[model samples]
Target chain A: METAISGAILAIVTTQKDKVASGVPVFFAKDQEEVQRTCILLSRVLKAMTHDLENGVYILVRH
Target chain B: MDKTIQIIILGIIVGTAARIYMLRTDYRQYPSYPHGIVVHVSLGVLAAALASLAIPALMEKEYTAITFLSLAAQQFREIRNMERETLSKLEELSLVPRGLDYIEGIAKVFEARNYLVMFTSLVTTSVALWLGLLAGIIAGITTILISMYLMRGRFVRDIATVKPGKLHFENSLLMVDDIVIMNVGLEDQREKILKDGIGVVVHPKNDNGRAILNNLGQRQAILHDVSILVGNKLEVGEPDLTPLMRKDVDTGKLALFVVPNEKDLECVIEAIYRTPILESAAYYPLKSTIGKSAAD
Candidate 1:
């Protein structure tokens, strides 16, 4: 059975970090499916709130 | 009687001490917290020099043996404490996921600046010899002060101090200080998700209570997340994703990552570009955004 997508919360870098630096994390996830689903939801919410968020690189491969 | 020999010896003592101070600051390990060393050490050295100048008779009692050794021991204790504090800071840096790049770049810059700071002290020795002990100490102290100021301003330490805020969450509605909506998305699209590819299709709904009737002659408008009802599944060998390999310390193959299509990704983005209309109640009012920024 496919992993049921679930919503979760995660914080991301609100500003630019150095080339090798990762932004300070303010969010967490319960599981992989939850995190993925939350990420998808977040993409929409951010686009609705701010359009710059939509300009991110999305990587997906056909199964 | 000329004091040329005494002046030479005094200059050597002062110059060597100053040089050593500059070197200590130059190579001082980072994340030096509880940091009272810079001001304290400079003050101590200057005080010692001033005392020697005020009463040159004290220098004749062979005070170098016990005094210098004790001073060295105290300085050693401070350095050890500093090293331990630095080790703790380094440990904290490792725990944080991001900012590794920023930290590394900052460390390199500090190393460079340290060299420049130490180089300035060499020039001070010549001035101290030609001028006097007081003049030499003043010039050395000035240089150290300037370098310290610059380092504090430019050095990369930690993220701009974070303050704790009251966070609240609800079902479907999350509020993070003043009603803010969260958003997320990926950059992949596909007809069928073998791994994690997105599927986009047009879902045209039929009007009220019409199960048999089709909506707008098959499909009138395209919408995101409408692929569940569309797209045919693979009949034969279970649809699989392309495999990927990565280098590891030991021999091991990496898990495959699915690539999303550009079209589907854009479609979802377009859908999100449409600001979220406040979904209240059916009988109540639905707050529709008349093409305005989401913040408003």
Candidate 2:
């Protein structure tokens, strides 16, 4: 499911709560701070491969 | 053996050569290596052959041959669509993508170039058939030169001034000159931008230049070209480091912030100047009657 949070400032894509499936590959953040925070949390805690897009950031998770 | 056949042969050779000379892989790099070159060259040969044959067929009162020319025109329109599709797909892969307006401008140019080749061949063939071989040679050279002149559209330097500017921060925000680029919340990334980044202010010469610079596509084109030329410092996870262009709301001056691999300020300025004016974004406000009266 795709959810736009913070008045379209951040977009999150996830198949289930606390479990990001492989198919959901993109995430959007409002600015640098949000992107960095999201990427760090996803990478370190969730063990996902995150990349930055110009406007937002995306993550790749296996199942 | 016939004079008509010999003249047509000469036209095809000259016209094909002109087309080949003009097909260069430069900054934009639309028609890439091997397959792309082959496709364009083959189409060029077909166009030249059809155009050269048109004169003799008409001279002999074979009016049906004119229909073939119309068919070729229709084919070239498909070429434009092909180019647009190819570039749009490739744009997805680019680190800094060429915007839709730039892509459309490039596609249109490819279509127009093919038509030019056809016209050059027709003119050369007509001259040879009516005048002589010497006249045909002269006409061929003249047409090539004329095509070359027509192909060179305006560049950014023709209408704007690019000069280096200092990058500073106002609290947490990154500012290039007086224009604010973005808010940098992290101290580390802010330092990185300050250490490696370069800034330039583009001052439009007139209303036309202002209008062109204001186009989002044109500004993006400039950022892309500059990044390609000097090389971008952005990594996959660093959204903060993406090159950005912002216009001063009051003055209409565009400020560009780039973190390039090569730090030479002059080279960055030169690259910005050499960036081609996107045909789709080109505005000629000064040429219009209303604009002229307003200026007066």
- Which one is best on DockQ? 2
TM-score of chain B of each: 0.30, 0.97
Instruction: Estimate, for each residue in B23-107, the C-alpha lDDT of model 1 and write its tens digit.
Output: 3432223333334445434534433443233223233455553354345445445544544444446645331111223233333
C-alpha lDDT (0 to 100) for residue B184 of candidate 2: 57
Question: What overall lDDT goes with each candidate model?
Answer: 0.31, 0.80
Q: On residues B109-200, what C-alpha lDDT tens digit does candidate 2 reach at each position?
A: 88998899899999999999889977997898799899889889999999999988989988766888999987654456778889999999
Q: Candidate 2: which stretches are off by over 4 Å?
A: A1-7, A11-63, B292-296
Predicted structure 2: lDDT: 0.80
What TM-score would you give candidate 2 relative to the actual structure?
0.84
Report the TM-score of the second chain of model 1 against its true counterpart. Answer: 0.30
RMSD to the true structure for each prediction, in A, is: 24.9, 6.7
